[model samples]
Target: MRAPLLCALLLLAGLQACVQAFYLPGVAPQDFKRKDVIYLKVNKLSSIKNQLPYEYYSLPYCRPEKIVQSAENLGEVLRGDRIENSLYQIQMRVDEQCKVLCRIDALSGAQTKAFKAKIEDDYRVNMILDNLPVAMVKMRKDEKSNSLVKLYERGFPVGFTATTSGGQPEVKFFLHNHLRFTILYHKDEITDLARIVGFEVEPFSVKHTYETPWDKVSPTLNTCNPGRATFVTHDMPPQPVKEGEEVIFTYDVRFVASDIRWASRWDTYLLMIDDQIHWFSIINSVMIVLFLTGMVAMIIVRTLHRDITKYNQLESGEDAQEETGWKLVHGDVFRPPANASLLATFVGTGVQLFGMAMVTMLFALLGFLSPANRGGLMTAMLMMFVFMGLFAGYFSARLYKSFRGEEWKKTTMRTALLFPGVCFGIFFCLNILIWGQKSSGAVPFGTLFALCFLWFGISVPLVFIGSYFGYKKPAPEDPVRTNKIPRQIPDQPWYMNPVFSCLVGGVLPFGAVFIELFFILTSMWLHQFYYLFGFLTLVFIILLVTCAEITIVLCYFQLCSEDYHWWWRAYFTSGSSALYLFAYSAFYFYSKLDITKTVPMLMYFGYMSMISIGFFCLTGTMGFYACYIFVRQIYGAVKID
Candidate 1:
């Protein structure tokens, strides 16, 4: 019965690791069916660095017929599955005299008025205009394109340009200026009331340019080939009209699709992951792992065995006369440190973050949180953190009690607030800055309130409940008893000093993960796609092993030095990696990113601080627990009088 149950558990674990989320295949453009009509959906307008959502009239648009997929999950939807068609009417005609093509838009008064009002009232629109308008086009696989999958199915918006008719060509207005309106109001003499008179478009000839991927066949062709591409220059903008006036905004449209093939549209982003770079990173990490593993084996098999054997064989008279090394400090080894409450709080929070990270990665590895699902990763993390508050409170309360602390309520409250409070406060401040800039990246007031509700309403109560249960149980017993007076730590060599030891301990863990960290940063800041969770999971496991082994080895050395003050040292040794991480981020910003604006720079550092804080907690907890287990095991093995 036991064997069968164990086998079942093993089978379930194996299946979970290999599970993948399902993705529906995209339909061919020819086979795609539209629901009678299509509308040109407007997306947020962006500049080179910033983006903001705007209000515009939903113009009726045309597209090849196909069944558009509806968002089946929040992750899929957040990932940008909410493309909608518009209802604006349009007409196009060609003139024979100059061979100039024109687009005529026919919009109703009511629709036009509402659109204008939305544009004027929304500050986000003004912010967008301040930068410039870039219009995006959504493309899917064309059935005739002989590709297995769509490539570059979705991309950033292209810029629009309008030129003056004079010989010396100058841009009259950009697409950013084209959508703007200037209205005139009229006053009735009899009623002495003012009303909107009319609105008009400032006219100019328009042209648009797009950057295309290099063609595989004609790879050597110069990019300035007008003959090989369709040009829609010499087009006119809409004429100005009054408030009650009706006018058409026309665009003479011409599309020049590139020869770039897509075996799968999703593969476009993944193509940037160079195969050689990935292999190099993997091999580098493996080499670090082997070095650390060999060092740990030497300590456990050779050094530790020698120390234990020599200690056990000491005669009674010699043992009393020659008490030197770790055994001399046995009584004080379990002694609680100063500011026990603070250390306990940090440990509890670290445990919470560690648990949250592990669960999130596990879900992501199982395909429940794929990049295709959009905001799935962040959503999963937030939800997991809220639920994991129980563990945070429980561990904090338990550790505090073990330290003989009396202020259980205070410890619990601090556990619930400290790290999370700092993170949220920084986030809220940065959000205010984003809001002031009127960028679309700003979290809305409603979302902010919702986050607060999640933290206080859900997480706090769960933490309290866990704390209550934790206090009900007895505190953990120490493996060795504490002395009435703490043993004075002996002077240590310069290399074993806390600062030098922590700095050295952090190097190996950071080295193991820095290669993967570069890719992660690229995906976040460079707008590149990251879909390699399998590799990420492997790196995460390696990091854990590296952290545990390094901390254990360092703790042993400290013990041999007769330094029982390993509590804070153990935590800082692992947590110091976050400091290195921040330094690397600074290097990345200066060397890789082209950002120059004050707001973007502030935002970058603010978010990086939060990431570093979480990493510090996660690593610090691993180091502490590994040291705790090692200390207990080595002490228990010795036959103490």
Candidate 2:
């Protein structure tokens, strides 16, 4: 007894350690040392340069190697009449009109004063000051500044570069004057350069011009900086451009950089600890766990009770006349789900895929596969697919046995391949598009093969195992006999149709999220920052509830109308989330974005469309299974002829 107790305590300790290690970051002590923080300086644009096409504008890709070659000769790259880089460290890509837009960054306290002084002194700079945060600027001596400035400003993202080659010791800050046409001097060498250029300088703390949401870990961002042209608007302005025709407007900005003090990774951790918890992960986990527990508990308890009660009655030889829930539908229990052949295949695959999804999500939430894990999610999802395939095989075989469906091989093959195949095909096409763009963020070829391997290796064998057991179970007997002649489905009016009801059921949930959808799309497509996982999870739960309730309510109404063909309709009714998701994404583009045309927009929504479909299937499956159980219970318990 003593030994056993000791062993149990040891095991518990190990588990606790594991949990703590995963949940917490930066518990160990580390030396505090500052690192290099890169800054950008965008030049100002002249009036004539503001209205130029993207094709006519050009920005040189600056690197240390190039910097050495063009040292002290920065004007070689700043030759264009336009303001190329309004935001720091970002390079702009051209649009159809050869113009670039700008994003604003928060200036350090010291930089703020200098910028204000420049604004007061220069009237020409004030004319193109749309992107500047008027609210922040208004709080100072410039009381006459407009308080309402739109967040988005039109300008170019001029190119700038800085490096800490020998680490912090060799570090220097880059600063630019209002015109950005001439070299003002480096902050570190300011005293030396001040003597040469004759301007007194003061030192200040250097911070990012704009806060990048994921900058803590993902600092090496070259692809998503401001001033880059949008992929979709490569061919905007349908007419052929004249040599000097204007397309997109641009603006000028001036920046100077200085450094006072720095924080290390350890410093950042301490700062976060001093502040409040991140809260996003914790909140999402708690709610998800609660909902899952409730759902699972309800299914387990009700199902076990009903099964035991039926078995006892059958054995007792009581005139099975009590005809209570689910048992009343003996005849229909094995009736093919509406669109049985199609739905059976689709859902079978979905069930398998679902199992995989659950495992992957659990692992991610548990920190086995975190954002830090990189491609771990893809790897895990692929492996789960194979295991889920096995479940699909088993479920298909069991349902076929219940139906006394002949040609077992056909059923098994269709069940095993159909749903997974469709999902794969859709995902594959999108992946191809991602590849064409040479996106490093896209799924890799090796991962795709791994997915295939997992399906064949894990899922196939498991499916066979499941099928063997499914075939062994005795077939369920029908309580009611089928009529020799099939009953004809009535011709309902347009509004009564399944398609119409599905569309209606989706409206409310879609409305609830359309506004939020803009932020999400901006993050993904426009490469904007978003880390609101907690709020997203809350909305997700609401979405799930909304989808399930609305679908069920519509299903109930249809059943009242005597429409028994709910199999596929029930699924699609809730499944309309896919349509709504795509539609809202489209709305975000047209209403919320300043996109030019089809290609990038199509690419953007296309990937999102696939994700929406996958989620649609997941939500729709939940609704279908829930309604199926409810219908089977209420109707199956009734003593119908």
Q: Which candidate number would show the highest TM-score if scored against the true structure?
A: 1
Per-residue alpha-carbon lDDT of model 2 for 556-592, expressed as tens digits?
A: 5565444556667777776776788887777766776
Instruction: Give the poorly placed runs of model 1, Cα more than 4 Å off.
Output: 1-31, 34-40, 46-154, 157-265
- In candidate 2, residue 314 scores what lDDT? 33
Candidate 1 lDDT, tens digit per residue, 486-524?
A: 778878999999999999999888898998999999877
Say what the RMSD of model 1 is: 14.0
Q: What global local distance difference test value does model 2 have? A: 0.44
Global Cα lDDT for candidate 1: 0.61
Using all chains and alpha carbons, the TM-scores for the candidates as numbered come to 0.71, 0.50
Q: Tell me the number of clashing residue pairs for each predicted model.
A: 26, 23
